[model samples]
Target: MMTKLGPLLLVLLLAGPESSCGDNPRYEKFLRQHYDNPKSSFSGKYCDSIMAKRGLTKPECKEVNTFIHETKNNIKAVCEEGGEPYGNLRRSKEHMKVTTCKLKGGSTRPPCKYKENSSPRYIVIGCENGWPVHYDESQIVTTVDNADLD
Candidate 1:
């Protein structure tokens, strides 16, 4: 589970040392929604909207952008090969190349055909216009999960 940031942090970033009325409740609500689901781009948009409405000066928009960029980099780094293959997936209509990933607690050499008998852990990164239209995996699943061969 993701740990949530508190309203105190939001207020500190926005209003500073002043506790005023008229907008405190709204600010608290916005902070709660944002911290609860920072991964949602729609939530980011909502935050931008709130900032516009409040006419308050806060780094909410900038924070959202930075958060997204950093998270993407972390995901890319998970599959990097000597920092060369950063898993920079690109949006495509068709699936791209299948490069073998270094499996967990396993041999460093490329997975053999016999070893490619199970589902590989992968993260779908590239999104076409904010929607994931395609995916390229390091390996493919041979056995179907919960398969209904009827």
Candidate 2:
């Protein structure tokens, strides 16, 4: 169960000090969070709008990003999912299921292309009020059982 966060764990491990942003009493809040539930229908312009709003523009476009589809409460519960401390952050752990989007095309300007990678993984997230509030860091209190994928 906890082993699922492998890929995401790797990302957190490599994340630099200034990777995420937010002020929700726990983890930094995303500039523009969106619901990426599997059943939802998103317009083709989804990335175009969100990228700008999140300040992911300027210089070069963001190469990769992720969207969680679960509720704030459900996400927070991940802290108790138990794994291992990701970094120096307090009370954080890895969760499962995320939609990762990678920039496509060679251009870094407008109309940035993107490819989606949706899967169940061990995601590193910061939690507050018994829920997850930000990503990129946290601590855990569990051990790995298996490295299965969903």
Candidate 3:
């Protein structure tokens, strides 16, 4: 019995920490981390202040990240009927403005300097029960005619 249960436990363990049973706490954390919009306009200080204030660079620097300039309701619509299924993620039908922040080379560790660039993009995200659980990536919609757009 113990031997049989061992494999079952292993499979469950291999599934990792994410469970789509309910509203995941990670979804809220994702919102907090990646969903801020510029009030006036994005500035040179945007990434620096936002990242540090949001605690992404506290213990160590995050390698890369993006912030979407839209409300949660708009982002939530990506998982609805309009979203295209791309593997385990849903791709947004509408384009959104996003700012990509990359860690600057040779920057001090604690200070974790970043360079930012903003662009229009369609986002891919993982959703369960119509709520976003993961931010996949921002995509440039080059193929408006292509059905396989991801």
The prediction achieving the highest TM-score against the true structure is 3
The ten-residue window of minimal lDDT in model 2 covers 137-146
Which residue pairs collide, candidate 1? none
Q: Could you give candidate 2's per-residue lDDT for residues 18-45 as a string of tens digits? A: 3443445335444244334442455755
Off-target runs (Cα >4 Å) in candidate 1 are 1-87, 90-116, 138-150
User: Local error of candidate 3 at 127, Å?
Assistant: 0.8
Candidate 1 per-residue lDDT, tens place, 17-131, comes to 3223234454344333222222333443433343334332232222211111122223333333312222355322222222221223333232211111112233333332322
Collision count for each candidate, in order: 0, 8, 0
Candidate 3 structure quality by residue, lDDT tens digits, 110-130? 778888878877888888778
Superposition-based RMSD of candidate 2 using all C-alpha atoms, in angstroms: 14.8
Q: Rank the candidates by lDDT, best first.
A: 3, 2, 1
Model 1, residue 51: what's the lDDT?
31
**Candidate 2 structure lDDT:** 0.54
Better-scoring candidate (lDDT), 1 or 3: 3
